[model samples]
Target: MGIKIVPRHGKSLKDKLYLPAIAGGMKTTFTHFVKNLKDTSNLKTMSYPEVQPEDLSERYRGVHRLTKWDDGSEKCVACYMCATACPANCIFIDAEERFDGVAEKRPKQFKIDLLECVYCGYCVEACPCDAIRMDTGIFSFTGSSREEFVVDKEYLMSNERSKDLNDG
Candidate 1:
């Protein structure tokens, strides 16, 4: 196949100097600055703690949480599908056979290292049983130590936002 080359458009002396481009950018900046200065209410700035915007989209993926069934039992079957699909390999799971027969297998231990997790939502998408989801709507957290960021099964289950995951 022959290579096809596109021709460049003609440019005047002023365009070559880049003065018009710079003036255009400065004009846009000055327009916005003057508009914001004239009307404080028109600015998009937020007071953060006091004035939080409630317009978050429903599809916003925030934090990961484990789902529960109707009978109060965990929905996960410990299939390792999430762990296997994680690109960052941040998820860890230890499966054990359930004696109660409610579930064929259950996670004896489940942990996720937040520091290593990329928050790609692959784990939630790979879960076959809808056992895991990233709908907590929580994006910020603090920890005293590295180990504290590693969330365990109990922490994931009882997190403040976990209860609201199924509401919508």
Candidate 2:
């Protein structure tokens, strides 16, 4: 079927419809482009670490981070709340004992395969003890191999912003 549209404004019928629309679209695009150009000079973009850092509220859940106590120890009770609530089921946790607290069923080896992570942030919400969080703001990962995408405990906890993957 052929598309039909009514003319809005112009001297000619064609000009009234097509020309005005084209002009209007061009004007909007030009306005946006100019705004972006000006913003580039100012720290308009979120550079994360270099420029502006993320102001994550309690609501923001980027990726699961095990919480720390005032004494600088893990807060994860390993209740598996996050794992159970995780829609993606990317969280793989193995709990162990710290002998510090009754809830101290800490993950002996906690892992999250980024390959399967949908970034839904559900895991963070499900954490009752606030043990797991996704607010490190270290939101960058890249790899050349399948195994590299699977984020091990070392990579997740090392506080490193991952870049290029290793070659096999």
Which candidate leads in TM-score? Answer: 1
- The TM-score of candidate 1 is 0.66
Which RMSD does model 1 reach against the true structure? 4.6
- Candidate 1, pairs of clashing residues: none
Whole-model lDDT, candidate 2? 0.69
Off by over 4 Å in 2: 1-61, 160-168
Give one digit per residue, the lDDT tens place, for model 1 in 7-62: 77537788788898899999999999998889898667778756645777677777
By TM-score, how accurate is candidate 2? Answer: 0.55
Kindly give the number of clashing pairs for every candidate: 0, 2
Worst lDDT run of 10 residues, candidate 1, spans 158-167
Return the lDDT, model 1, position 160: 44
Error of 1 at 84 (Å): 0.8
Query: TM-scores for all candidates?
Result: 0.66, 0.55
Question: CA RMSD for every model?
Answer: 4.6, 9.8
Question: How does model 1 fare in lDDT?
Answer: 0.85
Candidate 2 lowest-lDDT run of ten: 159-168
